[model samples]
Target: MAIAALQHLTDPRLAGRIVLKIGSSLLVDGAGCARADWLRSIAGEIADLRAGGQEVVIVSSGAIALGAAKLGLDKGGRATLADAQAAASVGQIALASLWSRSLGTHGLTAAQLLLTLEDLEDRRRYLNAASTLARLLENGAVPVINENDSVATQEIRFGDNDRLAARVAQAARADAVLLLSDVDGLFDRNPAEAGARLVPVVQGIDQSIRAMADGGSASGLGSGGMVSKLQAAEIAERAGIALAIVNGTHRAPIARAAGEGQGTLFLPRRRDGARKAWLGGRLRVKGVVRVDGGCAAALAEGGSVLAAGITAVEGAFERGDLVEIRDPADGALARGLAEYRAEECRALIGRRSAEQAAVLGYAPRAAVVHRDHMVML
Candidate 1:
């Protein structure tokens, strides 16, 4: 596919929070050290954004690269899992210190958060992480997040910061996500290929779009390629968050991407009901609740689901886990964050608010699934 010309940028910074994923190639040098001057420049941009009342969250890569540089462990450009983890242990401290110092120069406080797949995948931990992020933003602190590579096994890791950024954006309910890459943007073919131009705006990613994805990082420092970025875009798209792929090698990458239309922005599904978007796009629904006709009618009209309306409960989900609301004929009707555990739900089946207290030996929340947390499918 031939790349289309650049369209006018939608001003992704128009409202709400933004997530920025910093690629290794952008932050780390070939010698495996942080680019101090470049970081200061990036921090200046962040300071400017913060002054404008726009919150920013960063998902930065380069721990392993920095570690490898420090340890001189680049054996044929590949290391054992143990060696990689050891490098990460040393690099994480170096990365965090550098981030803190750079942002501090601008009088901005940096909070380092090392996360693994479980932090975002587990319901309880997800909420905890979300709460912490919310508090940091509220207190005017910039969070510098990274994968816990030191402890994260290859099997249980996010491998690339691109998808992690999108997931963080979804969890943080950011209005937009920016993936700063080595190349200019999403190209029609390998960016190194001749006559390959940048695609300004992605309508939606399909198989053909997937075919256009490039291979792994040529620098051999980063794990992500254009393919991982598209996957990230897909995640952001489903979460109703516009995601942009822009070159981070520039001076003001964020400003350029959001204001000057300098990259390929994947348009969001819709921003009007982002909560609903997140709910609907959940990759895993821990349980299913079959609701009666009356409840279904109420839900369709944007009402909450009452315990009295629930006929059956399936799946051993915990409180706060996502669940599917179903009807016999309609199949899955909606998705919601459950207020009660599966066992408690079963005990409260067909019971009203008062009866629920007696059956479960405790007063239940007003709604089985609050309307605010439920999205009609």
Candidate 2:
């Protein structure tokens, strides 16, 4: 069956490439370590997807819990980064080994891939990561990815698997990302509090959505709470990838999210493709630049962002960071990701592309943002 068939059977918006993010809380029991039966169940669901000819990549988070169990750490205590790393070192091996064994029983193969922030941030590395996952799908082997916690320092840790899952979805060009956790879905307020209500769907990530977040709760095995889950959802939505935050404690949540049954489902924004959405949905921007009225009109007509139309620059950003491109005449014409850097374009501002070399002392690229990269809003 086609991948879209799964979505049509489940939810029309849910087919295509899928990434399942399994958090630590769902992977272990109170005593910690990989839960054998749970792993089996997960593997079985994965096998079903593979049999259906759908691609599935799992972003798993349980190395710390696995290591802690092996080393005997309690739930409430704090572990130094060293302690966490040491535990992850031991746990990651055991975790991958267990998954391999479990999947093997179902006549499936699992490939272990360890990643750090560096692997996703560098363009070459990002492409390499995408290529590796794509190859695994083609071979009918499930690619199981995990953050390399043992060696990751504070600076580059994915912090939680939620963000990691979103990044992976973008890299793999996934149709959806399923984040399996203890909660059934997002709530209007703390679910534990008496007044809270279950929010069936969220159309956009806005201030209203932000108000609903209450940090980590009962499932202490993982670091992310509803807030982080929403953050991950925002990432997926921007990439035109559907996302669902569902309770992982159930027998087959991943399968359910794929459309066989239950979970809190989210639809992607209908307006743009994955690449443009990524460029527009940045949480932090390095800089801002204003454009003249004529430039704004041209951009609205699907023209490239050019140096001659730039009126002002703000902030400092390097190549590829999401930026604000505003119309000097009015802010209404502003869109995101016009491409050229603040420093790089500052000198060429007000000068035609041909005169750019003589004025800036170097031959600069023609368009501030090539038409292909800039998505007009």
Candidate 3:
């Protein structure tokens, strides 16, 4: 069944947001210098996507490789953490400049975002990062994201851009994730072996699927191998995001991946439901809000939880904390990330959203929990 799916693998009609992860090997040569021609070709592809009204976010790896080349550390030895950090600092500047220049030729602006694991793990920081990416896309700029390797220790680092790309897809609510790597797609066995074949469409990831992945980087310049990409697929799957792995060595690889379906596609398990399940299951419930019968009905109809609908707020939860919503009878209706702190919610219960300013000192949002942030039980 999987082999049959491979024969007909074609790109789905991907619209709106897309996250493209570029491996270090695709961006740097053996000498560790940025591949100028390849970068230009990719920039052209991104420009085409944007021209067609698609928002593109790039999670790129190459700063360390580029830095290593520049600092004479590319002499074929494993670099120390300090050496890696120093190289990242120098390479990041060159990387940003290269991307900026490449995209600039096509009249596109590139914005650099250096992130660490903590940025996505912390709820408040996650929202901030999401908002920033949204704003960049809204303003017609492409975000070039990279791990903050300069200050990141081994314990705090994401260790691979494959997983980082998946997290970015969740944060941006991207429609699709494209991993540009050395290989065309996932195979049942090593491609170098005789009779090895591509497995193009994966509906679900299982132990057998995972067993297919060999644990070594595709190129010396990259740290993530097939295993990391599969792990990334699982993360993306939980967020209900489609993921594709494509060979990025070809010219206009992004265009080919999107149009010709030149890669393996991992279909999402359950669109919105998967994301809601992941969100609700992962967070700790810090508080509860009780609402009237009318509000309960509204929640059931998939409406946002408003201040006027809330009758009472319990427990001490801060903004961005996960909280539960309950009916007047104390039956749990839903759980969502709180927009306002517990004290603020207490002061605004039963008050109309318009009257929030009069009831409290300020009113930033009308809904206590936005529909997008809420998971209905």
Candidate 4:
């Protein structure tokens, strides 16, 4: 229970890591492009956090908006998928330039990373992307992540950057996620509608809260709505990452949210490091390995999956890849970092670690899969 309580952030995770998402609505100036003063203020706040030893990554959504403004496209109407993608292609450069200039004022560098769902889906790419983001944070540079809007097709899209930010938080092993928007936080209903009120704290996700969310219709310059925000929160919560939704109208809202509790915070059910959280929360798996009920219990109780437990292995993959671990009777049990190559794992089924030398004629590593690299589903 205390671990669950820890999710709400009694003390700021300032010195810890965080992923901050800025919506298109929050980044646009009256002229309908990136706001320099607002960005400068945000960069200053981030600078302050970094000075205090905090690591931060920003997931910003404003490329399409800026692109539309620059190209003189219809500001109030929907764009075809092609139209939107083209705008994003042109806008991302300008957006990054603006952010770079602002961050330069604080003597900090911002690295632009454009990603799509494809990047997070493959094992090697997932590891590589996570490594890149981690190195940037460790080097004290702010990583600016955005949807690879220009090249992504329908099948590989992250519909909103909010959910992507949540995944980024998990990938970065961040302690918190801050979502900046035009409004302050989630309201009982649309705040623009009468009788709506802001709900300050959310303990868990429920249908009552889900019912209050609006649709994805953008108000001219922004794309996400309350629904995307809630979805993003759910993703973060499931990964044991705390989320805060705050108004971006004020300068340094992120710092204020962390220090003054000015935003609506959604707490997580548990605390997990990045690798475990990602392994546990991944929605898709490349392959499945079924084990007996005994093996499932061992894993649930914090034991490593042994070779004897593996009954079946499906899919073609190499060692150091991600594979799903399941109970033969009940199906999905957990996911782990595979130690043996897929073909080798199949050949070694029902064999012990000590038997590796006899079976393969070469002494192998001790574990079929190690607990340190695994997460129970």
Q: What overall lDDT goes with each candidate model?
A: 0.81, 0.75, 0.83, 0.78
lDDT value for model 2: 0.75
Candidate 4 TM-score over all chains jointly: 0.72
User: lDDT per residue, candidate 3, 1-377, as tens digits?
Assistant: 11122222222334468899999999999888789999999999888878877789999999999888888884422378888888899899999999999999999999999999878766678779989999998999999999999998887888889988988888888877889999988999887889988887898788889888977886878889899899888777766777889999999887676566667988777555644744543334789999999999998998989998899999999988889999988887888899999999999888886789887777558589988988865
Candidate 2 residue runs with Cα over 4 Å from true position: 1-16, 72-78, 254-262, 271-316, 319-371, 375-377
In angstroms, give how far residue 87 of model 4 lies from its true place.
Answer: 1.1
Minimum summed lDDT over a 10-residue window in model 4 is located at 1-10
Give candidate 3 regions above 4 Å deviation: 1-13, 74-78, 272-377
List pairs with backbone clashes in candidate 3.
none
Cand. 1 Cα-lDDT: 0.81
Cα lDDT tens digits, model 4, 1-377, are: 22232234333443278788998877876466677778888988888777776788999988988887777767521277787788888899998998898888899999999998878766578888999998988887899999998888777888788888988887787878888888778888878898888887898877898898877534556767888888888778878788888888887776666566676778776766756776665544567777877888898899988888888889987787788887867556678788888888888888877787798778877677789988765
| Candidate with more favorable, higher lDDT: 1 or 3 | 3
Candidate closer to the true structure by TM-score (higher is better), 2 or 3: 2
Q: Which ten residues in a row have the lowest lDDT in candidate 1?
A: 1-10
- Residue pair clashes in candidate 4: none
The deviation in Å at residue 304 for candidate 4 is: 16
Positional deviation of 36 in candidate 1, in angstroms?
1.5
Q: List candidate 1 stretches off by more than 4 Å.
A: 1-13, 75-78, 258-260, 271-377
Cα lDDT of candidate 3 equals: 0.83
Distance from true location, Cα of 377 in model 2, Å? 8.0
Between candidates 1 and 2, name the one with more favorable lDDT. 1
Name the candidate that leads on lDDT: 3
